[model samples]
Structures are given as C-alpha cells and as structure tokens.
Target: MIKRRLNVLLIEDHFIEIMKFKKTVSFAEIQHSITEAKDGAEAFKILEDKSRMPDLILLDLNMPKMSGVEFLSILKNSEELRHIPTVILTTSDNQKDLEECYRLGISGYILKPLKYKDYATKIEAVLNYWSLNELKKY
Candidate 1:
C-alpha cells in the first residue's frame, strides 16, 4: 500500500510537547508535514485558509485561550470544516471529556502516555493509521 504524507495540524500549548511530537515523527522517519498552533484561536486562523486545510487535526485539551472541547464544538458545527478528521490527543483521561469529544464527532481520543517510548508508539500508530486510511480532500 502507498503511504500518503499527511498534513497534520497540532493544536497544543506546551512547547515541550510540540517538540517531542516533532522528534517522534522525525525518529519514525515519517514524511508528514506538521503545523503547530499554540491554542484554539491560533488554530482557527490557520484553518481559515481553505487551500491549506489539514487532512487531520490532533488537539490537546488544556489550552490558554480556548479549550479543546470548545474548539471541537465550533469545528463540528461548521459545515465546511466538520468533515475534516479530528482526534483528541490529550493527557486528560476524564470520562466526561471522552464522552464529550465523541459526542462532538471526534475521530479518536487518545490519552498521552507518561513514558516516551509509549508516547512514540501511540503517535506512530495514529499517524500510520491516518496515512493509510482514505481521507477526503478539501
């Protein structure tokens, strides 16, 4: 099977987490391009460009400006952006958060592992799945 290079939008606040994700992708030798957003507001700005719409969005729950659930609500409500696959990549393992995300139509919900190796494995699996799966072009 041909591996598609994904355009991933990572909405994360922590600098270290962003760096770690980039490192993991590099270590895994994945060719996907990543776009970083410090918060949900920044993410909206990035998403405004229809020509550069991401194939997948990896969102973190705790953010300064706008929370992940809030962002997800707005995203899912939009007719134009609703079809883009969004997955919650957060440390929050709260049952309510998981239920809410699923209700908001998130493609997946993943809890961030404490160990680096586990985190890398999960990230790799998520990326691999999305890269191989059929995605709608905007």
Candidate 2:
C-alpha cells in the first residue's frame, strides 16, 4: 500500500459517492491522504486551518449551506486560501457552470458517478498533470 502523502480535501455532499471515491482513490500507489467535508462551510474550516490545508480540493457544485460556486468565490477572494487549487468534481455538465468555474480560476473539473474501471486512471492523470505554478499565471 502506498502511504498517503498529500492530504486531499473532498467537498461533496453525497455520502455514497464520497465513500466510493475514497475507496477508488486508494492510498496504494497514489500515496495521498483523503479528507471529506459534507458542505462548503466545513471545507472552509479545513482550508482555514494552516495545518489541515490540503494541496488540492475536490469540490461539488450543488450542496447545502454553501455551494461549490459560492465556496470558490469566497476562496478566490480570500488571501489565505486563494492560492490553493480547487477542482470542481460535480455532475453538472452545464456550460454556464463550467464557464463560471473557469472564470473563478479553478484548476480543473471532474464529472462524478465515476466508472470504477477508469476512475483511478483519470485521478492519476489529474494528480500527475497538476502544476500549481503553471496554474497561477492562468
């Protein structure tokens, strides 16, 4: 088993999907930690903590209290968490959502109900291809 190195934050409300994702993105090989928050409010708390701050965040667009868009807006506007890259991991395929996310400066987005067969590969690609410095200039 690969030891978790990076602490990944997942801000998804769906319990089943979250559980599935946790299992799919294994500690083996990938070697990254996983943290889940049911809502944007909780995610904000995680981001607020300098120690709990994750290298990456997997966010969902539709949620209770604070939506992904709302959270992104706040984070982008916050001096402390603005630099952290957040990837929208939602089922919304709407162009508007996509456009808004890009405008808000998200690192990337991944659709859910992920096929077990290809989920790991896609995640690996996302993690492997992720570049914080390149994202800053965008």
Number of the predicted model whose lDDT against the real structure is largest: 1
Best by TM-score: 1
RMSD of each candidate?
Answer: 0.8, 4.1
**TM-score on alpha carbons, each prediction:** 0.97, 0.84
Write one digit per residue (lDDT tens) for candidate 1, span 9-57. Answer: 9999999999999999997656899999999999999999998899999
Worst 10 residues of 2 by lDDT: 129-138
Residue pairs with clashing backbones, model 1: none
| Candidate 1, run of 10 with poorest lDDT | 23-32
Instruction: Output the lDDT of residue 31, model 1.
Output: 80
Runs of candidate 1 with Cα error greater than 4 angstroms are: none
The residue-level lDDT of candidate 1 at 39 comes to 97
* Model 1: lDDT to the true structure: 0.94
Task: List ranges where model 2 is wrong by over 4 Å.
Answer: 1-4, 131-138
